[model samples]
Target: MAGTPSNEPNEAPSSGADSAISNEKNRILVSDLMGDEREVFLLFNGSEYRLRVTNNNKLILTK
Candidate 1:
């Protein structure tokens, strides 16, 4: 017999690092980073990059 699929909604899997990072106070919110915009430009090590929130509310960073 085959196993049945779960009926519960899928959720993001949590890892040890996720718990540790959530407990730390040195984190910044994504909303704060975007600041009323869906995208932001970042300059790191003399290279420019683009950070943006996708339509599905996920973040994407590109050079």
Candidate 2:
């Protein structure tokens, strides 16, 4: 089968269309998550964490 599709788990996407679809659905802008704020709090599994934008414009996450 010279032109058959692959069902292999390790196969890369055949075209930009496949990658673009996944990128759009799974990606989020950092600006949207931290709008007009330098810090945001996140909670997971009954624990709290802090996400901060440093003065140097780098991100820091801490528990």
Candidate 3:
């Protein structure tokens, strides 16, 4: 084999709504928001809003 498999075999393709989410990883220094949760941040298409997912899969929106 010329390549190795992905560690995340369960990873699925993005949907139409998910496609609108920015694929880019953003490193944000959130001294205000950081506490004790895992976060998934995304930028939506044509919107300045930001998405934040927690370790518990909770959703958060910020401008």
Candidate 4:
């Protein structure tokens, strides 16, 4: 028998992020977290970094 529906009030699931989100940075990248794509930055200093979340749900970080 199916117990009370999961949506029962006062009985919600724990708060956490979905694994579907690409977390390769913590699982792959070994650099830095400069900023996201929507940020505005001038190309200067020793090196420039950029983070992009593509429409295909892909996370790309470049320097």
Candidate 5:
């Protein structure tokens, strides 16, 4: 059990390209991703999601 891989939906694999990008707590500025824009789209597992920054500076994500 100790060495068994997790079946948890939230568990991220610890290898390969995803691992390289996910191993650390990478810090990315919102300005870098959403420069001059209030919203951006994210593609994950073939689905699209929208991320928006509200006037009050709150973030919202919708599918």
Candidate 6:
């Protein structure tokens, strides 16, 4: 049987939040995420997704 996912709302870390208290293993810098390129490919569940840093310095993820 499939398990029910949590219904809690996702929230961003507060300005005063402690980094140590958060999950560091899953954290990555934007530069690292882009990896010397404006666009990067992300693979999830056998599907491909594109992550891009827009010219305006915004992020966009597309399938």
lDDT of 2 by residue, 1-63 (tens): 767777855545568787778768977787999999999999999999999999999999999
Assess the local accuracy of residue 49 in candidate 1 as a C-alpha lDDT between 0 and 100: 100
Per-model tally of clashing residue pairs:
0, 0, 0, 0, 0, 0
- Displacement of residue 34 (Cα, Å) in model 2 is 1.1
Per-residue lDDT, model 2, residue 15, is: 81
lDDT of 5 by residue, 1-63 (tens): 777778765555567777776755576888999999999999999999999999999999999
> Residue-wise lDDT of candidate 6 within 1-63, one digit each (tens)?
336567766557665557555757668998877778999999999999999988998999999
Of 1 and 5, the candidate ahead on TM-score is: 1
Estimate TM-scores for all models.
Answer: 0.59, 0.65, 0.25, 0.29, 0.58, 0.61
| Clashes (candidate 3) | 0
Q: Candidate 1 clashing pairs?
A: none
lDDT of 3 at 49: 64
**Lowest-lDDT window of 10 residues in candidate 6?**
1-10
Better of 4 and 5 by lDDT: 5
* Candidate 3 Cα outliers beyond 4 Å, as residue runs: 1-47
Candidate 4 residue runs with Cα over 4 Å from true position? 1-45
Predicted candidate 4 versus true structure: per-residue lDDT over 1-63, tens digit per residue: 367566655533545565334443346442343343443333558777666666885666677
Judged by whole-model lDDT over C-alpha atoms, candidate 3 comes out at 0.58
TM-score of 3: 0.25
Q: By descending TM-score, how would the candidates be arranged?
A: 2, 6, 1, 5, 4, 3
- Candidate 4 has an lDDT of 0.51
- Candidate 5: lDDT of 55? 93
Clashing pairs in 2: none
